[model samples]
Target: MLPVVNNLTLKNYSHLANSDEVSFDVVIPSLPGFGFSSPTPKNWTIDDTARVFNTLMQEVLGYDTYAVHGSDWGAFIGWSLYNSYPKSVRATHMALFPELPLQPEQLEAENITLSKEDAFSEQLWVDNSVGGSAYAVQQRTKPNTIGLALYDNPVGQLAWIAEKYISWSDPRRGTGPSVLNDHEILRVVSLYYLTQSFISAAYIYNQNPSSFAIPLSKAKTDAPFLFSNFKYDTFFIPEQIIRPLTNLVYYKSWDFGGHFCGLDNPPALVQGLREIKKYWHY
Candidate 1:
């Protein structure tokens, strides 16, 4: 399945794009293979997507400098843009910055003391690693196998993706209306199946195995970076932990959003993105 996390960003957060206060033009790519965008070559990595995206901005669109934002695997691709072409990419904002969560054993090995909320996030990481990531494993190893299986079976595809939307999001369904309701989930699945991009979307995992195991050493950057941490999100490594390793200029947290920050809390997402303008020269 595709990173529904990115799908949420594509569908929601119109406040940033539509706001009169935000003066910049918004260009959101369908990201290689999520919906209408064609799937990349089997060997293509996230960096390839970044390279083409940069070309689209600087050459095709005739923009000298720009800012970027993303979540989920989109964050990985966004990181590639900032790391490889920081001069062109003036600033970076991410709902989910590319921070690899320490495994339970590694956490114990480090013997780090964290705040209660941060510790809870670390525990969530441990739990998700064991149970919430089987789909990722299957997709990473056998995209085609499952892709073919679900290509024509729209119901199967919908079910496969809906589970992720339900679980990864913040836990607040019974109390009130969910930010992403049934209609939203159905919308994403329908788009995937209708475009026949269901199979190709899964290839992102198989093609970019490096995303899941990204080394902290690669987090270094000279360009301004903003991270919006949603406390209820799947895996959150605290700012204090990540600040020393990178050029993390801004870090904010909220209890509202989850993996789908754009959908869960668009205002917060918009605010974080706008905050990057302070550092961006253009």
Candidate 2:
């Protein structure tokens, strides 16, 4: 599930009229080399994470099948579970598209016309590709260099994560100027710094070179794929382009929210995730 402010699983999913806890149990693992999780081999990637999570759900947790939800890299992980283990994953709801997102220039070259909304979405994708991918490259190419550089420097690490949170999130909010404020960004930075996971977390980009390039033919699955596209998230592959990627059973687009839709728009994220429950069989 996408991480909410304070692990609001039952609250967002909502429990019984009187009960405080949500009916179903919530399982949120710290991905390998993330948060409090242990270190991982240098070869570990999103697929590795997915396989491990599959085992966790089936072997350790003893769940026959479960609903899946994620955003950003979490989107890639969610898709991997559905693609690799269809029978084990009942359904998936994602806030971002997993495949290599289509570029505006690519669409233009193909003579494809997009609506105004789609146009803006593609533009944001292009802008992010230009300005926002530096951290990805830095982490992917030489994680240790930066990781150690900022290992003892909490302030530096804060800037690293805070920059993305500021630039990527939808600045529009009903209650505030930005979806994520100083406190929210600091929470993640503090976790990374205190846990001393700065370097380990960066290894994901290094390990997952094929995160976005996976071909649609290889992504087939029996379980339904539910997509929730938020405007500011920089993933805006059109529906026609997305339909061929998997068993895309459901798709919803929002005018607001950002990469962290759970934080940017909690209610919408909950609604999108809850949709998969209807498709669940076990």
Instruction: Return the lDDT, model 1, position 214.
Output: 57
TM-score of 1: 0.87
Candidate 2: clashing pairs of residues? none
Cα lDDT for residue 200, candidate 2: 91
Off by over 4 Å in 1: 1-21, 108-111, 173-178, 218-220
- Candidate 1: the clashing residue pairs are none
Instruction: Estimate the lDDT of model 1.
Output: 0.78
User: How close is every model to the real structure, measured as TM-score?
Assistant: 0.87, 0.89
Q: How much is 220 displaced in model 1, in angstroms? A: 6.0
| Clash count, one per candidate | 0, 0
Give the per-residue lDDT digits (tens) of candidate 2, residues 1-282: 244524344444444456533445668888889899998985877888999999999999999998788777888898888788888887888887777777767787867788888788888888888887888889888888998999999989988888888788787743442346677788879999999988898888888877777655646577777888888887678877766776778888888788877777777776676666667676
Model 2 residue 262 lDDT? Answer: 75
